[model samples]
Target: MLKIKKKFGIDELVNLTSILAILFLAAAVVLPHVRAFRYFALIPWLRGIGLGGLFVFLILQAWIHRKKVSELFGHRRARSGANSALQIVLFLGLLVVLNSIAAGHRGRLDLTSGRDFSLAEQTKKIVKNLKTDVLVTSYFKETNPSSMRARELWKEYSYLSPRLKYRQVDPDKDRARAIQAGVKRYGVSVIEAEGRKVEIEGTSEGEFTGGIIKATRGEQKVVLFLEGHGEASPNSQDQENGGGLSTAKEAIEKQNYRVEPLSLIAHPQVPASASLLVVAGPKKALLKEEVSAIASFVERGGKVLLLLSPQVKTGLEQWLKSYGITPDDNLVLDYKQHYFVDASAPLINRYPFHSITQNLPDSFFPAARSLSADRKMPEGVSAAPLLETSDSSWGETNLLSRNLEYNEGQDKKGPLTLAYAVDVEKKEKRQKTRLVLFGNARFASDGAFTAVGNGDLFLASLNWLAEDEDLIAIPPKPPGPQPLVFSNGQMMQVFYAVMSLPAFLLFFGGLVWWKRRRS
Candidate 1:
């Protein structure tokens, strides 16, 4: 054994002891306060213990060698630059690891992009009251951009609730599973609950999420076309060489509404699930029993969309009177705002300010009837005008004769009421029954449907009546048509005068100068 002297200074021992004590206190108290430091304390404690044992071992080695403690520990000069760089690298590494753990390796935490916040309240109601487990499997392949968009949407649904699980199945890799899951196409989200599955085909999160909401709480809207009169059927031909409502039936059906011809003569009892009853351009009168049934239906929270034509010869007018709606026997003719080739075809353009026609463009109404509300509405019933003729308009009493003579004093002046919506409050329930009366049904005819939002107005009215406004289908954005572009003459003029003329002059001038210089 060699006898050695301890050279460790009192100041060094004090400094080391103080640092160890502070670190221990920080681990005991501060580590619990900070979530990040709690795990760090574990590793630091093991390293400190091992390092402390090593320090004692080094001290023993120093004692044996009888040398300075500084010599055993190496140089004491601080390299600030190197220390800062090492600290920065360690901090960045720790931060990356911690973030990965927190995010569950699910990519960047993007809280900004999501479904409409306004829909959150509605979605909460749907999710909270869901009776069955809804398994939403998004069968999306990475090849398509829509699939990526669908995944992002599914992430929103998952964030809403843990009950909603999203499983990503690659159609190509998992062909067998995809076939079993009934995934016919890529970018398809399948929502299944209570043994019922609805495959909604769309890439838009709003559309896909809306479909899910509809799937959960969708009500079937049925539109009954009052037949037995000369009203147009779904298969009716356009006899007048003008547009017919036959094409509208297909459009309505596409909105998940079942359009069935309801001949009150054959079936007197109105279907209980009838969301709306449509009386379209009837040539004959409604039977007494049919009128009573309609009135009773109106009294019992039912919805009606009445479209009266100038050719209506029915007592349906009287039945409508009981509900405080009176259709005058005259065709609405607007002299100020009309769309027509000649005096025979009168086109009324102005519409009233109502939700149905609020955003609609200027429309052409051909041979529309005039309507008016009684001075007093029935008890608990509310009425609002939808469309009215301009101050220059007049009611043509002799509409069938096709005589284009306007009697100013005889006809009702401008602001002739053309359409109205009546809400009849049911005494039994707090809810009210809706009735929309339009002067003309032919506006929804196939030929005129696309003429300046006429079809949109008709669809909107029907939606309002059925109380299915949210389910109203937005018309698909038309594919890019031939963009109104510059004509050939304009293109040639631009090429020659603006572009080619200047370039040609510059080229010839440069060539002449080059030839002169060379000569």
Candidate 2:
């Protein structure tokens, strides 16, 4: 060993130094860049380790073998050149082993600033609890932007569960497959499970997750929206003024619930098949008979969701008081936690461990009213607050005032209740009553439904009301314009890296060729 080492001399030491550089590069590529170390970032340190090893090793080799290197390539076919082949083969074998180990793990780390690539907690829950095989088929051009993005997302999904499979095809290339699947256009994803299929467009997490939910749903429940009191139409998609419940309706339907607008005037009684009743933002007063019919529905162990806007005389307010949920006649105003430029839209971030609000983020209620849950409740009735304003919020009595300020004595101060969940049960053969009350319906309207947490809030409320706690997962995250923009300095660094790699290899190749030609 010593003889061999002495014969090779500095060249052997230089080869050992190259091993260090390769190890550093391999580590940098394999490990995830989750955080920057206190001393330095992972990539930069790895780069420094590799380049520094090469530099120091080269210096030592130059000093030791100065006499030998001085004669560039005059030697004819030196026997020493054959030794590199064995080392090269061994190096390549090491790389194959490292990459195989990495491939076996089948996991990836998201490095986006907003973590947009990361799946929501709800999506994980849905995928992990899958009971059957699911296939996601996409009809799109391979090079299309949406197809590429969907494929990237599917890489994570494929790792999440073995039950979820994905396949993509270029519609132009596979016209027969596209036609068989009933897909007429591109950019469509069909999630199929248990003989059911949900077709969707777009590549947002919310859109894909929603399709999974529908495809995997077991039973179809019914949600009836009360009409005829100027309530927001379930079919209206107008988002200009925020008076449409269409988005909310779609969200409910995604959870395997069939949503239908019910006109009490046409059929005075709540149907027996209704899983829940939604009275969403009624502007005009409900007729006496209509209000009576809703009361009858609640009395018979039915679930009800009542969402209200401020300054409206909803006749059910007094009726609701009898059941322990009271409506305050004021607009909730929050100066601290609110949407951008609007204090009227109180933003709620934290929540108690209730099933509805447990998995939600910062949500805002626009032009909302206040609801007071009765401390002294009726027998077999209990209420819990679902949504609340910030500490600096207030309930304004004079909503019509041109310039509004919190009245010290007249107005209510800070952390007012915006919504409540009421549970009712009795020791009888009849079913128990469940109720969810909200201060504002516009939170679920088309204008605000896709807000960070607005749509989830609506869906969670429905889940609780329908007694499907398992379905109370978080809604799809609302994606924003998060285009990756590189700085000029960063771009220049990347450019140098891109150019230097091939340049180094070409120079080495030229040196090798010059020596061989002399042979």
Best by lDDT: 2
lDDT of 1: 0.66
- Summarize candidate 1's per-residue lDDT along 193-311 as a digit string, tens digits: 66667787775544455456545555657888888778766667584644357767765764557788787787677888888898877778888899888877776677888887775
TM-score of every model versus the real structure: 0.59, 0.69
What is the per-residue lDDT of model 2 for residues 57-136, given as tens digits with 9 covering 90 to 100?
76887788777765643455543554575589568757755654555455558897456667877788888788888888
Error in Å for residue 263 of model 1:
1.8
TM-score of 2: 0.69
lDDT of 1 at 25: 42
lDDT of each: 0.66, 0.80
Against the true structure, candidate 1 reaches a TM-score of: 0.59
Extract clashing residue pairs from model 2: none
